[model samples]
Structures are given as C-alpha cells and as structure tokens.
Target: MKFLGNKSVASFLQVILTILLCSIIVGMLLQLLFSFWVKNSSNLNFPLQLNNSGLGEFARITTPFPVSYGFYIFFWTLVYTFQVMTAFIIFFAIRVFTFFKNNDPFSYKVVSSIKWIGVITIVMSSLQFLSEVVINIYFNHLDKLENGPIAYVRFNPGLSGIFFGLIILAIAQVFLEATKIKEEQSLTI
Candidate 1:
C-alpha cells in the first residue's frame, strides 16, 4: 500500500528515526542533570549509624574513601558537557534526515555538524570508560579503613550501557548520512 505518495518507506524510516533521536536526546539531558547533581554533592558526607561492633570496626578501619572533590567535579562536568553535545548532534541528524527524505537538498552545515558530533561522542565515551576503569582499580586496593571497591565497580554497567548506546547511535548516523549521499548522487546522475 502506497503512503505519502511514492515515499512511504522513506517516510516510515524517517518517522522511526526521529522518535529514536528524540528519546536519546531526552535521556541524555536527564543523565546530564543527574551527573551534575552527583558532582556537586560528592563532598557532602552521609553519616552511617553502626550498632554492630564488627561493622563499626570495619568502617573505622577503612580510611573512608578520600573525597577527591576536584576529580568528582571534573568527571561529572565532562560527562554533562558531552551529553549535551550529543543531544545537539541528534537534533541535527533528525533535521538532516527529514530534509533529505522529503526530496529537499541536504544542508552541508548540518552534515558537518553531525560528523563532528559523532567524533566527539566517540572520544568522550572512550575517556569515560578509561576513567571508570582507573577509578575502580584505585578503589579496589583501599586500606581496611576505606570502603570496599565493590561500589565503584558496581556502577560500571549502567555507565557502560549509556556510553555504548551513544556510540551505536553515532555510527548509525554515519550510515544514515552515507545513504543520503548515495541517493543524492544517483539523482544528480
């Protein structure tokens, strides 16, 4: 069945891509806000009440995780910055895709912006992965007074998922742009 004249397939694909793009943008914004909160409040101490002598001893002996206030702030700031950049990229990707799908000439500026955004997202995600690994390794060898490294390691999965998702989205955008280029070339010929 034909829909939207002869462009049913293209229209359908564009609609789905637009929805996915919007969802990613919203998710990135929420993540940015959460990272900001974590960074800002990283220094606030949360007292834990201990009734058991064994638990109290464990807590006391541990050197209580040294709050590297600066590191925490820097890490989260970087995350927020990258997420916001990724959102902008997604916005432009949707715009470019819609434009091309409608048989309109694609904007070179938008295409260039997507390319840079994809590259930045990939680099930022890599740095985040490395930072998390380093933090986990350092925390694992903490003294008896310090908290166990499990907490640091435990947070890895969620962070990794977000990073991987961004990478996948960026790659998809590259392929989508490539197809648009091919279609434009065919039309020109």
Candidate 2:
C-alpha cells in the first residue's frame, strides 16, 4: 500500500474525518435547537448530586437544586464554543489529509492547515480549562458565601488538552521546516 494517494491511509482517514465533521455539525445544530427549547420552556430544574458516587465521604454535594438561566446559557455557550473549535481542528485535519491524498504532503496549504489546527487546539484548550474551573466552582459552592477562599481550585483535565495542543504545534513547526526544505530541493538543479 502506498503512503500517499487515494488508496492510502490518508484517503481512508479523510473519508472518516469528513463523516465525523458532518456529524458534529449536525449535532451542534440539534444542540442549538435544544437550547432554544430549554430557554423558552418553564418548570425545568437541574439536579446536582454528588453523593451517589461510591466514595462515601469524598462527595460534598448532597442536595439537588435548580441552576440559574444565566449560568445555564453561559455554560452552554462555553461548551458550544469548545465544540466549534473541535470541529475546526477536525476540518483542518481533513484538509491535511486531502493534501496527503493528492500526494502533496509538503504543500503550503497543508502546513498552514496543520498550524491552524495547532493554534486552535491551544486556544480551545485554554477556554475549556477556564470554563471547567468556573463550572466546578459553581457546583461546589452553589453561589453561597462562606468563610473560606474565593474559589476552590482543583486539578483540571484540560491540562492534557494543552499538552496535546503543544505537541501539535511542534508537529506543525516540523512540517513547516520540511516544506521549506522540500521547496529548496525543488529549486536546486
């Protein structure tokens, strides 16, 4: 099997990524509709319970309460933005694969797409981290003022995302250098 061209892994992944991209778009649209419906509907209460966790004493929240509309909208907006960013990353990946299918691995378009993916991933990861922190604080404190710290900081899962973004950025840099070298070779006699 060839590394590049229509019959190679890149082509297969391109097809898969295309399908995934479509699915994400459709899901986002559905989520938008759901958000509108939830906003207009009344008597809907969100219950938050942490005692169900197998950890006996580790769990803090035991009572269920309704979340505010402002928080709900904010949370969903953050989540939606994250999904959009993820779709952009997938879109860029698909572009990269398309270039691979065309046997143009070192093209400027491929390098640019890869770089965008890296940059978006980094920004998306930062947003996710900040949102997670805010959400966690809301859940833990439930907007109650107590004699303690302003916010309880916890280890966030988004750190892994930042690491992956940095890795992608490094890969993009390598690809840029490779493209430069390839262009130079083409120019040489």
Candidate 3:
C-alpha cells in the first residue's frame, strides 16, 4: 500500500534536510573526539562562554576542578550531557521538518516531535544555569582569601529559549487539537 507523505516542500528541500542532518551528526562526533583528546592530552582550556567579566566566565580547559578532581568530572560530565541533549534536539527538529516537507504537518508524530523539542529546550536552559553556578562556585573558591571573595555571577537571561519553547509547545497543542478535529470530521462522513 502507498503511504501518505507531505508534498508541500519541493524535492530539493529533502536533500537540504539530509545534508543538515548528516553535518550535525558529524559535527557532534568531531566535538566529542576533540573534547576527549584535549582533556587527556593537552591543557586546552575550555572557555565557558558567559556574559560576565569575572568569576565562572572561564573554566580550566578540560575540567574546572583544578584543586578538587570531583568537580572536574562533574563539570565535564555536565558539558557532555548537554552536548548530547543539544544534538538530540537538532536531530529531532530536522526529522520533524522532514515530515513537514513530506506534507505530514497534522500528524500526531509531528506534534509529539515538537513537544519533545520544547521539553529539551527547557532542559538545556536549566542545565546551562546549573553549569554557570558550578563554574562560579569553583572560581569563587579559588579567589584569593586576602582579597575578599570576588562577588561575581554569570546569569544567563534565558528568556529567548524559554519563550521559544513555550511557543513551540503551544503550536504543538494547537496542531494536536486540529488533528483531532480533522479525524472526527472524516469519521462522520
């Protein structure tokens, strides 16, 4: 039997989607390997890019725990964990868009995919906040005791991501209700 598919997107869109998916996967792999190599073989500092000038803005190249080893492991694990989650989010989006390209916009699968994306977005933001706190704490501990503790913070105004996730979540709900209505209408005839 022939399967239903989205026809709104042109054939070239599918090709582009495939290219994006492949590149994302490759990039993640390269990052993973690079992280390992740098952490184990070199003192490459992993710059914790933050919107702050002091404390927690930077972590030691591989791990942040220079004095304590546990913090290093914890920080690196957190970094990789979020990296994997981000990769999943990107992959999920590509797949959902592919469904749209095939014209399956109202399908339950697409709605679910969107919901998952929103969930991950919130999760990623939370993880980043936690990471900021951890890095700052580490740096604060390292601050010279005689100099008085440097009061610094890396607060991520995570508004844009949260807003975007909320919007996506709302869109998913709308699409789900629309799908239900369409199904009901079909059954009545």
**TM-score preference between candidates 1 and 3, better one:** 3
lDDT of 3 by residue, 1-189 (tens): 223355444334556656776776787688777865665654424444444765546443354334456765786689678767877776677667777667666788888888999989988787777778777777676655423333455567577777888888998899899889888988999
Q: Order the candidates by TM-score, highest first.
A: 2, 3, 1
Judging by TM-score against the true structure, name the best candidate: 2
Residue pairs clashing in model 1 are 61-144, 61-145, 62-144, 62-145, 62-146, 63-145, 63-146
Show model 1 residue runs off by greater than 4 Å.
1-66, 105-114, 141-189
TM-score, prediction 1: 0.46
Clash number for each model: 7, 0, 4
Which is better, 1 or 2, measured by TM-score?
2
All predictions: root-mean-square deviation over Cα? 7.7, 4.4, 6.4
Candidate 2 residue pairs in backbone clash: none
Model 3: worst 10 consecutive residues (lDDT sum): 1-10
TM-score on alpha carbons, each prediction: 0.46, 0.81, 0.71
Greater lDDT among 1 and 2 belongs to 2
Model 2 gets an lDDT of 0.79
Question: What local distance difference test score does each model get?
Answer: 0.59, 0.79, 0.69
